[model samples]
Target: MIEIAVSALLGAVLGTWPMYQHDPARTGRTSPSLVYTNQPNVVWKTYIPGSPSVPIAGADSSVYVVTQGGYLHKIHAQTGTLIWSFPIGGACWGIPALNPQEDTVYCTWAYDKKRWWQGHVYSVRSSSGSQNWEIILPGGGSWTGNHLAVDQTGVLYVVDCSNPDGMVNAINPDGTFKWSVPVPDVGGEEDLFALSVDEARAHLITGGWNSERRVICLSTSDGSHLWSVWTGSATGISACVDPSSGTVYHPGSDGILRAISSDGNPIWSANLSVVSTPALSRDGSMIYCPGSNAFYAVNSTDGSVAWSKPIGSSSSPAVDGNGNVIVPSSDGHLYLLSGSSGNTLWDVLVTANPLSHIACAGWEDRIWIFVTANDTVYGLSALPVEAKENLPEGFGVEFKSAGKSIYLFMPNDAQVSLAIYDAPGRLVQRLYDGVLSSGGHTFNPTLEAKGVYMAVLRYQGGMKSLKVIR
Candidate 1:
């Protein structure tokens, strides 16, 4: 049996980890593939001031979004109510990153004023719209493909392109500078895009947008230079790192994808010509690359084409619980495709204008997907909300998580007892034991072990159990 580790971190990060084995030689993709074949219905929708350039992040009871209007808005996940809005007084073209352990969200913004370029790295409290720490980044260049990344250690990394020559900044969770590395110039311009962190390997990998367009790696501990490999033409968007294998996958502007080891050794390079970042399967065996007008699934080990299909303009692809490939295209539509065969399962028009990348949240049979198009943000349900009606009558319990808290919802009040047990049926702790009222209940359990456990709830003479990861 595959022992899946549970965590308080919700959505993609929690679902993808150890469940998918990291085999550098594993050419096969997901087995017992989960695919969504029907068009998902939109559950909720909201409007923003400007277009969103980054993927939306959902945590706790809120969804965090950043708009080009220089506004960061936190909205209720179940409802489209606005929680709070924070202004950066500039353009935010990048996505916001969340560190569940730190309980903070990190984002970047840039604006021009007077004779200098102004840029900032904002670290804000995830629960509240309050600032934890903010630091001004150097340079004053346009924000194109710049990405902000945070590791499990709460160390934040960002590429500042405020000047013609870009630079990388490493900052602490408290918003202090750790180290800064100058991006080497190529030709007459130099910019960086697509940043990722391999926390276990203590390495930061990023790609360049100009000059020889190199893929560079730096030491995360001290920001020291490590190795730089020249990828032909431009390095596209960002790269994906497999911490288990110390492998890095980079997309190229010249329609090629390169795989390099942590030591800067070349593994293999394939023709992808993708401009955006590529998505890796949970097991790190398959790579999904999106080009100007097509999508390709390639073998992670040899870069051989698994399958290719015409998908039109789209951002990076996201895989759902059923192993279904979700792609949001520039044509104002979202398509669900078969993960193993690249066959279209469903197509739904999600927005009127183009779309930013997609973000998702999932728990068991339910999946929530969020996408931003033009000035509108739409939420879709892979398994419609009405499906909940199928639950048996009586007291019902559902599990949800974000950050470091696990939420439990009880439909009706009754005498209840809650406890957690390890995979071996060893009771870890008793969370609650008493009469409770109806509505949502939350438990902030201290689960430090990185493994699977069971949550057992007994109420109203009925018992339900859930498998939880910490």
Candidate 2:
């Protein structure tokens, strides 16, 4: 009797071995793919004066936008309702950085008057249209661009305009000066147009507008100088630091992307053939940058070409949670590309000219994208579930069993297995196990009863299930 019991236990273990030995390379289910090949679903478009150069920030389903018209407008991200608007003294030409912890946003703007440059920094409350703090810089030169950086502690870093002797100032959360660090005079106008922070190293990276193309790594803790590296020319828009690798991606006016190590050494560089700005991916795996006629994606690890698709002249690209890339092009349309393969997912035409700076925000189930041509703002429903998955890849699957053969065809490589059950859920048979590459797969179903069977295919990054008719 003991021998029989031991044999039964052994059989049980063997019978469920396939399930226990299931392949660990299963892929998660991804939403369907979509390409916006139609006119924009235009949520709302507003008008602004002059070419705008600022990004929109969203908090709690509300989007806050600043425009060159000296207007700060708060709108509903879903319905584009005008919640509130604040008018500043100068043209708002920079992206607004939000500090949700303090319920405030920091923005910068500049105005010109008879050879003088005037700039101001404003801290506005997120709850109500109220000003928390506002500071105006001295009349040295005009602030041509926006360079704002905020730390985790809510300290603001900003660079003053065209003044050769201008410096970067740090403001506390309450709008008090923490410290000010003067940028060493570069002989010409000090055009510190862009800046980034390295939280781990406690350093800040600032670039654009110097006699020589260079990036200054400043000590964030004490506002002291750590190091600076010269690239070539200061023509790029922003600099991004890869925390995992401690490398800086700087796009220069010379139309080249240079990778500088944490120690200020050159790692690799690539030319995009056109002046453009660089934007890093959330996962740090890819870098999307605008080229002359096409936007390009480079593998962040080794700076290799991943993919490039035509989109006309464009600005920095924004990536969404579902890996959709949105970029505003001179063609008067916003192009959305698949993050994985650089495939054109969608395009929404707004105006004849789109703003160089497009602000994008993503939330629970929606995405908000803003364009600043004629002050037009659009809030598009995140593409529908079916629209998101309209990839060229095969979609549906069917399973069948006749005589003694089971057949299947899946889009990608998957671990194909069979589970059999009767009307009462009694265990029957598992026809096959292991991985199945792309295309059709077949297995012998000799022991599979004609009642019912379920075939499941699991692949890296996705999975699919099919019901088999026997």
TM-score of each: 0.74, 0.68
Lowest lDDT 10-mer window, candidate 2? 17-26
Question: By TM-score, who's the top model here?
Answer: 1
Number of the top-ranking candidate, with lDDT as the measure:
1
For model 1 the local lDDT of residue 311 reads: 73
**Model 2: residue 161 alpha-carbon error in angstroms:** 3.1
lDDT on C-alpha atoms for all candidate structures: 0.62, 0.56
Per residue, candidate 2 scores C-alpha lDDT tens digits across 147-218 of: 566654567777665456546677789888877766655422355556666553333334445454577777
How far is 460's C-alpha from truth in model 2 (Å)?
A: 17
Residues 1-470 of candidate 1 have per-residue lDDT tens digits of: 22223434532221111000111111112111123454677888887778754444433646777888888888765566778888867888777776634568777787667544567888888678888877776544434335666554556777765355657777888888888766656312245465666653333333444454677777787777788887665553667666557688776667777899888889998877676667666556788887787888889899999998887655777765356678878788888878789888888887777766776653344446667777777877664222344664222566555446667777777788777754222357889999888889888666776655556555663444445655
TM-score of 1: 0.74
RMSD of each: 8.4, 16.2
Model 2, runs deviating above 4 Å: 1-40, 49-53, 111-113, 138-145, 187-192, 201-210, 363-365, 383-470
